[model samples]
Target: MESTQVHTLNLTSVLSVSKKIILTRYWHFVSLSILLFFPLSFSLINISSIIHLFTDDHSNNHKLLITYLLIVYILALCAIGAISYSTHHDFFGEPVKFFDSLKSLTFSFLPITSTAIIAHVIICLISLTFILLVGTILMLVHNLGFVVIDYNSVYFMWFLVIMGVILIAIVLYFYVEWSLAFVVVVVESKWGFAALMRSSYLVKGMRSVSLLVMLYFWGCGVLIVLICSTNMHAIVITTLGSFFFTMFLLRITAANTVLYNYCKALHGELELEVGEGFVHEYMNIPSEN
Candidate 1:
């Protein structure tokens, strides 16, 4: 928890540190992933079944869908909390035990879950507001005869495309800003809006790195979805896909935790000690100037 200096890490360094921690503590993370992520993966893989349950006519299916969703949500929260806690410890060169990580969740789980829910709600609201605002603007323009807002017109199509890009940019901006909220919750015990605000503050001046980190994992997720979609009925393929997806999830969680520390160091809020073990482990990597 103590260090002599803070190192400013680029995206490569952030990922390098994450990789090293996972490699060194491979078994510990695997155990945590198994306890939390394995079931979560199973739940995610059966998402189509859950969707079918929702559309089925039987009241029993409704109950099953609700129950399934609740379980998956809890598992997702636990996975995030556990991985965040373990990664924080490992990154700091502190002792990281699987059971201790779970035990720490007794205090952290609620806060982490609350922060996650709040973040999702805010993102949803932003998307909804954007859609509503665009709809209203289009209506007013049509009503005022500002232009012939023909649905099939090339201009209208271009307008929609432009709006779509802006909306995506807005979402990506907030996503990068709030990317560290879960890590903030686990590490700082700040929850809900507070954690989000703290994340925003920490991520300042580092939005580009945060965005790249987010996009990298997001691309991996998309690739996993593609693999799973193509081989849904192939048990071996599905299982392996789910397993790698879970691993990437863990890696991204760890990367975010490391990024959080890097931000703290950059801002002079923390002095992050690179443990001797970490240094020796990656001694061959050229030093940053």
Candidate 2:
């Protein structure tokens, strides 16, 4: 009976923490946060088009978009890199001035700058492979019409291939989604080896919360796109995609801040160890939250 009571309390605590996070708003930093992600998404979509262009040659002009995409992507990365040291500002759940926090975030990330370079390299390699794989798939679809009865018709191969693609999407989603926490680990925690692992530990039981947060951001992004589309689809797509990516980055940044604070406290780097009753303390808002 005592153990059952403990279990109920634990569940209640998790729910409360999740609710607290959801209720909190960061309207002040929304635009800056969006800036963090916009270029990367455009770069990705542009890469896809570039691959299709090379393989099909049907839309040769789109190569220009790819060039623009890569150039913009590189510039955005450089901008983030420039400000990487300033990402660590937290004033107890209160709104922070963006420039001040940006400065802090950059300094906080200094310890892992080299590691970040390595990670970026790995991602670039994977992106190249991904483009190649996408090109291969497109080539197969165009040359080998064995799976199609009519131009728009599909046979079993089409369904099977579609299923395969959906499965791949699910895998990619989980892979990227989980690692979103790593950047936080990179900056706020000084220790290199333990930073990423610490984030993984903190995020361990919070997968459901993370997924819901991602979904909410995605939906909000959709609404923004709709609003912007009323003016111009191209402009709105660019704006909406950027907004979604920025929010995504900010959430990762915020989640890492919370986790790093908690772990630092646990490791005696900070003054307290915040656990199940973490939020009940006065300093919870000041130091831990």
Among these predicted structures, which one has the highest lDDT? 1
Worst 10 residues of 1 by lDDT: 278-287
- Ten-residue region with minimum lDDT total, candidate 2: 1-10
- In the range 1-289, model 1's lDDT, one tens digit per residue, is 3222234345676688789889988998987886777766655665685577686666545666777778777887898898989888776568677888989889998898888788889889999999999999999998999977789989889989999999999989988999999999889888999998999999997788888888898798778867685777888877887788788778888889888977876677643354334433332333244
Write one digit per residue (lDDT tens) for candidate 2, span 128-167: 6766776577669868975433435566468557756865
Looking at model 1, residue 4 earns an lDDT score of 28
What local distance difference test score does each model get?
A: 0.79, 0.46
- TM-score of model number 1: 0.88
TM-score per candidate: 0.88, 0.48
